[model samples]
Target: MIGMFATSKAGHDKDTVYIIVQEDTEYVYLADGKYKDTEHPKKKNKKHIQIIKKESDDILKEKLIKKQPIYNEEIRKAIGGIVCQKQM
Candidate 1:
C-alpha cells in the first residue's frame, strides 16, 4: 500500500497522518516527510493505522510505486494538499 495515507490509531503519534512507504505481513513503514522521512520511516503495526482509501497526489503515487528517490518537501506538500482538501 505504498503511497497511501494512514492515520495512526495508537501510540504517541496517534492522529498523525503518514504515507505508507513500505509494508510487510504484520507492519507498515510510514513517513510524513517531516520527522519521518523516506530514509527513516516509522514502523507501525498494520492494525494500528487507519488507511485513507481516497486517492491523493498522482505524482507521489507514481514515484512510490516505481521505487524512485523522493524528497521530503514533495511529500510534505502532497500531504498538505490532502489535509487542505479534507477541510474544505
Candidate 2:
C-alpha cells in the first residue's frame, strides 16, 4: 500500500519484478522492463501480483527527497534494487 516494488505472482509476468504505479479496488497498475513507464502502466488483477512494500520504501524516499518525477527507468531501478537485495 505504501511501496512501489512487486513481483508478478501469476500470469505472463509471473516472478517478474514490477513497480506499482497505480491501484484500484480490483486491479493494480504495474511497470517493468518490457513495460514502458508509469505513464503507460499495465493494469492487472491485485491477486495476480505479489507486493514488495518493504524494499521499495527506500527508493521511494530517495525519489521524494530528490524531488524527481516518476519515470520508467526509476521504476526499473527501484524494482532492480529489490531484486538485487533479495538475491544477496
- The prediction achieving the highest lDDT against the true structure is 1
lDDT of 2 by residue, 1-88 (tens): 4345778888766888877666679998776745546567788888888877565666664663464666666667777777888899
- Candidate 1 residue pairs in clash (backbone atoms < 3 Å): none
Cα displacement (angstroms), candidate 2, residue 21, comes to 1.0
lDDT of each: 0.89, 0.69
| Every candidate's CA RMSD | 1.1, 3.3
lDDT (10s digit) by residue, model 1, range 3-88: 89998999999988888988889999999999999999999999999998865578888988888999999889878877887789
Q: Estimate the overall C-alpha local distance difference test score of candidate 1.
A: 0.89
Candidate 2 root-mean-square deviation in Å: 3.3
lDDT of 2: 0.69
